[model samples]
Target chain A: MDEPEVEAMDEPEVEAMDEPEVEAPGAPGAPGAPGRGVRERRLHPVTPLRRAWAPVAVGAGWAVHDPDGAYRQVTDLALWTLLLAGGGLVVAAALYGFLSWWFTHFAVTDTELRIRTGLLFRRTAHIRLDRLQAVDVNQPLLARVAGVAKLKMDVIGTDSKDELAYLSEKDAAALRAELLARAAGFAPETAQDVGEAPVANLVHVPPRQLAVSLLLTGSTWVLLVAALAVPPVLWLTTHSPGLVIGTGLPLLGAAGASSVGKFVKEYDWRVGESPDGLRLDHGLLDKEHETVPPGRVQTVRIVEPLLWRRRGWVRVELDVAGSSNSVLVPVAPRELAVEVIARILPGVTVPEAEALSRPPERSKWCVPVWWRGHGLAVTDAVFATRHGLLGRTLALVPHAKVQSVRLTQGPWERRNGVADVHVETGANTTVAARLRDAAEAELLLQAQADRSRTGRRTARPDRWMAQ
Target chain B: MTQQPGDRYGTEGSAAAADAPPGETASPEPVWRSLPRSMLTLRRLLLVVWMVPLAVAAGLLLGLLAGPAWAAFAALPLALLLWGWPLLGRNWRSWRYAERADDLLIQRGVLWREETIVPYGRMQLVEVESGPLQRKFGLASLQLHTAAAATDATIPGLDPREAERLRDRLTELGEARSAGL
Candidate 1:
């Protein structure tokens, strides 16, 4: 057997068999076929969708959007009551149809995974087994209640629109395992041991921390709750219970929703090695777990938001090649960042132990080797220099990994003699880090970009002292 | 109207247009060849200006029939607003993919006219696509997916028949490159 090429794992993206990338002299006939190496391309006759409530669900949803108007036309109480019952049935039937279609419409063949959809006129798309890169399983609110889940397979040919379904958790898991095995660079491994709750507890948060986390966010919901603040203040002065309750009710509801969301969204957030690759699972309404390999990672960015900075925390994101552009692990206690670098890189040189023992500068542009008691020797960071409260931000795109660099100076930035540099890295993972440099940082950026460990020592700059 | 950048030279890719460095070719396919005349849809320019306003006018006529003066009046501005999007599409670009011996060259970008060279050795996949319009025009665009993080070089625009021939060459080159790696 050919010795495996990539270290740790041999990761090759397996996009589903999309429209055949027919490359022969003619569009038909395989260049080499009648054998195993030649993948067979077949459009399966779609399995009849159990559509057996999608229309009902869609109709019910439409009715829900305009509730009273639906029955308001019926002045007769008895007639209105009958109409309401029929409406409810329609709604239930639609939900049932949606569930059935979502669950059973997907099929996994030996060489391809096929999804046949569209209500009136069916459309069938087959993604080749070898083309698949990764599979991401998401559980919406309905999925949890019904013990169903949605699985999305990332394949090379994008002609395949996203395939969504509401499959039984057991079936979804089995399908996921099976597809992962067939996908190139993926082999069936023991599934992750996610608990019943499979949620993160946000253990470090203190009591009354809602004031710190939620209120501080000033999210739209918080603003909605705050909008009622004035009326309550007036009512409290007048001592009118009706006015107070009316305004207070929404505030209570908003606060409850925000707190619960904050607590639930970050629950059981785990990022670690999976059999095929890295799996990150988080969120509530829709629980998402994504698997990606290092080869597919185009850019890796480590950021410290102001609040997280105050807590001495950081967030890591990967511009994944297979999935959506951004994959964020929202909370990390600095060490994990280093562990990530050490465990998941090619040639990373950890800054000297003594180098990390230095003090942090007040300016946000630079990350300190040490902040408070914490050590910071990260090669990648997006912090203060590009941070903003409401308006614009200046990101610090590191020089080493930039595929191509775009430097822009607006009239205002030009006036100030400042320029924003966007360093695009990797096609899929366009992780760009920008810094505020008038002219001095150019040498540093260029130096980092050209710094390659594998290159000959003779290729080094004339100023090379490390050798 | 939004005051967009009038024009600038530094932002243009005039300098990056120089021929690639020596010994860079990694595949055996030729990058440049003739293509069909039907690649660009001049008719799209008409729809780009016409369709949206027609729909808005139709909606406005209905509103006027329903007796809403304000809604009828809203049609003029709304139709203009709807039609404006496609007209201001200064950034939309066209591309061409050429398969040459040892490399796949992509010519793209509107004002900048940037051409990228992806030696077959560096490319991992060759993707070809033809949207509805491209199909009508008998043209296809090919994107070259590479393992490199910074940029996945792409070459698009080919006559349908030429696209198929080049696609085979690119695939062969990509396989050979991976094998060598």
Candidate 2:
């Protein structure tokens, strides 16, 4: 294994030489500089152990699934032989992991970041620095224990394969800063210390508030009601308490596990405003640091759950193109949510008491219950729509970010003279005004197209640093 | 003017007039172009190819398992094919695409009316695809992709030459008005 791994490590060096290398002139860290320029690095030495742990645990789980059969099979083998076989398996897995780790290498040049990995089928990704969208540092529980983190970079129009795992936590932070600085078009020596930049702390969610919010979620209540109602009903019908236990235990366990997972994932959520963008830091076992550049934010959503409404709490989430939907504020006061939105999207305000156009009275026949909550507001800068009955969702999409507009009507809607207009964005967050007057829907469709045309004309340039 | 079946759905002249804003002068009616009639034939041919095999298998199985009377089950696929014959035509006729000043309009569906307006500037990619059968039928499909995945608009069953022309025009417009997502 070691012999083959050493041979594979030499292959990327030969391949790298075949590609044209455009070294930046007067770059403080040029290709030849020992400490500064184009230094190719490998992941931490503990990567093999970390990589092998997952598959080993999965194998253990399968063995435990049928304990009796596993015991009989083990007993059939001599003790010494069984021990030898288990040791061999462990050695084989470790060798495989080590070989993979040995073959992987990454380097950051002036213009691009290059990652080369894979054993048999080598895959190389060249991510241009100018196209970088955001940088993130994530530390899972095991990696956290090992004092290592993963550096992930989001590039425009690319699916995520731009990740380097098992770098020392400190090294990950430094590398992230360096990459961000380079992406912002600063020389390596002149790059400012991003860590020292003043961050105005916006919102820090209390543990108590987070716990309460998780419990107040719609799924939790539904599960609670089912857990309370199903067992008793089953007992009355079947007269067997055993069947009730079998059915009720799994339901309770699932609900508890799901709630606990969410709680741990969102523990100690904090949002801050910095020059780079909105900084989000959260996680209990796995720490995550993410930055959302204001320019990348495509849409914003403020959600008011039926239960949280009375408490005047709302969850804020935003869509940043090239990345997944991220929670800006998991749970915060309405004012705090608004403030966060305003920071992410400058010059835009969340309408509080504005009278938005509601679907016509006759359209109510289609959506009897939700008709009242449905509303659409078209502003110069943003298009806002509100809907939902038990939980209200207010989606705000900037006209500049609108990708397209659509008008749809079903057979039922046609008879009711109602239609739905969808305002689409590059991200998952869409502003859909449901069940509006048919003529109004058509007008909205055309008007939104016009607005988006003008919006794109005056929109900011894609390169944030250039501006 | 004699009312065409499509006029009942308000897909043409009157719909465009109604779509204009209150104060704006009514813009010239967009020239709505329909898909080729050969597309209906292509669809019917494919339907027959798929249904014929299933009908034969059903007839043989029923005849072997039960009795000759149950062999009538083979008629189910035939019935579906016959029913879909005219339905496919309506669906084909329902497909219309118009390239406007700054955006492309695609109106489709029979029971559920859907109109997609994809701005030229927002288009990220455009593709022209043709299967072996479609090639034999002299047909190609033009697909418009935007930054938003939801903006899925495809104009199928166009003359191959027309598809290429449209693709080139759209790509040129897209690049000229390209607004980075």
Candidate 3:
């Protein structure tokens, strides 16, 4: 009912200041407070330059391509011509970017955050403060160099595409704190204290160790073997070094590029704890600062690759309700990973290997290789499952967060009297126990349903701060 | 496995049954409701509407270009229609839903059997939709949405009145047992 009125308002830019008080009665925060409503603000002026870089680079690359002589050195005239063309392209792209930046405006009211964009077909998106899930501050390499950051907000029941690009880093952080405070039901004046909340660093991943772990990954090994075997085989069969160069170079380049991407993406991963929630700061090229509100985590997964296991390392990933950056700790010692898990889901123990219920021996026909590794455990607080062959993954989902439960049986599984039980959550990480006795699977389903019912009854309230 | 209008499960009395104490002994045999058999007719009608024209066009094109022997390939759609006729009925029979005290159970799939248990507390929204064709046939489909996308439960081909009643009942239950994600 309130949404329609908001959407029907034609002149949001001129009338938004006074519209919220009458239209949205139940919206969070004090309505009609003097000087409390934030005025419409434009992004940093440098936003156009930062946004235009990608197009400028592409245009430069296109201008440099010569069809006449593929490997010919560029003449002085051609070089001058390329520079002039690139300059013209940059100016055109920057003008377009500036127009877009001028049209986009965002403002914060007592009740909601409103973002208006589009030059020809204007659109307005309203995010209720009460439904704000999390806030992320991202800085792309160019934006970082330009000293600006982008703010992304995750709202409940909506895909998170609401981004305020190219805000001053200080402004973005302050705005993030203000939004978090309002979402937590704090008054405007008291919201200032939220920004100063002390943070306790929990985990810091070393760059060298991260690089080593990436090298030890299965893909890297496959790429290495292919690189070693393909050149020799190509030489012997085709007798043309040119053919080897044609095919082998691109393959090696691609592998190298992906490995380099990962290395840059996860260069300096760090996690910290604050009174509000867990804080995650990561990336080398495009630095990202994400906050996972307490009780927002749906599932926790600990992965141990075959090679990582020998070094007693594991990767901890959390399926936070709204944010997409799920890596809690990319690579850490087993004990440190457990400690991080404990910090996230307090008082819940990770299921020990001994406590897991292994599938019946007769069900081994379903998965001969990984049957022994497959196990399921239903604890009072969480449902845990262990599976995977080359890399062992132990997934733990809090019973309170279980959205639904499912049991599936294929034709082959039916013949083997085995079934798979999936504990579904709102996040992508689903905890599943594969190849279990059909009878046990049925019982587990019922038991899980009952446990989830009780868990929901005793679980923390949605508004953690209010509690 | 066609359920007649009279055989439809009465929703009027289920409110009291559902409100009973959770501690009560579980129902020994929960009532399972099946989709109306008209769904089969609707599906078959759609299949014919889409395939007949394509089949005729294929037969004409092949007869002109590659000789009449190639026109035999046009029978593929007809053959598929005939194959799917009984398979759709069997799949329809396999579709059943049961409303338990605390949760709803939807069991489906003929080859890969899947049983989804969605707790009433977890239901975020309940929708009743009727397309133009379905409206012409006096039928509607009820969809149950939870936080998880994987909990895709849709009961298609229900009497319009029954679909509305079920949607109202489920919405009430969901509100009463609402839980945070």
* lDDT-superior candidate, 2 or 3: 2
lDDT of 3 by residue, B53-150 (tens): 88898899999999999999899988888888888888889888888777888888887998888888889888899999998888899999888887
Model 2 gets an lDDT of: 0.78
Q: How would you encode candidate 3's per-residue C-alpha lDDT over A1-467 as one tens digit per residue?
A: 12233234322322234433242322223232224335666788887875587786774575567534533433535877868876888888888789878777777654577776666666678887655666789998978887889998876544544789889988898888877775665654566457844689999999999999898788776876787679889999989989888878877876776577778888899989986678888999899998776778899999999999899999998887667677889899999988888988976888777888788887778888679899877666788899887789999999888998888999899998999999889775567888878877877776676666657766655445653
lDDT string for model 2 (A1-467, tens) is: 11232234223221132234423322332233223335566787888886677667876887799888878888999989989988887888898799878767777765567776776766778786655667778889988888999888777655645688879988887887777665665544455354434678999999999999998888876776787889999999998989999989988876776688778989999898876667889999989988765477888889999999999999998887776537879899999899888878877878764557778888778888679898877666788889887888898998889999999999999999999999889874567999988887887787677667657766654444443
Q: In candidate 1 chain A, what residue range of length 10 has the lowest lDDT sum?
A: A458-467
In candidate 1 the C-alpha lDDT for residue A11 amounts to 41
Model 1's A-chain: what TM-score? 0.57
TM-scores of chain B alone in all candidate structures, in the order given? 0.52, 0.83, 0.83
lDDT of 1 by residue, A1-467 (tens): 01233222324323333436322221232222222222233221121122434555666687788888755744445877878877887777656565334332444544567665554544666776554556777777656766767677876444325655656677667667666554533332311122122222222223244234444454545556575675668676988888777777777666666666655665556666644556677664668777654334444555555555565555566654456626445556556665664444434433433443222233223333212323222233211122333322222222233343333334443344433434444344333223334452333233222221011121222111111
Judge candidate 2 at residue A365 and give its lDDT: 81
What's the true lDDT of residue A215 in model 1? 41
Candidate number achieving the greatest TM-score relative to the actual structure: 2
Taking the tens digit of each residue's C-alpha lDDT, what string does model 2 give over B54-167?
999999999999999999999999999889988898899899998876788899999899998888888988999999999999999999988888887889889999999999
Q: Roughly what TM-score does model 1 have, to 2 decimal places? A: 0.51
lDDT (tens digit, per residue) of candidate 1 on B104-152: 5454444333334455544556678888867777778766655544454
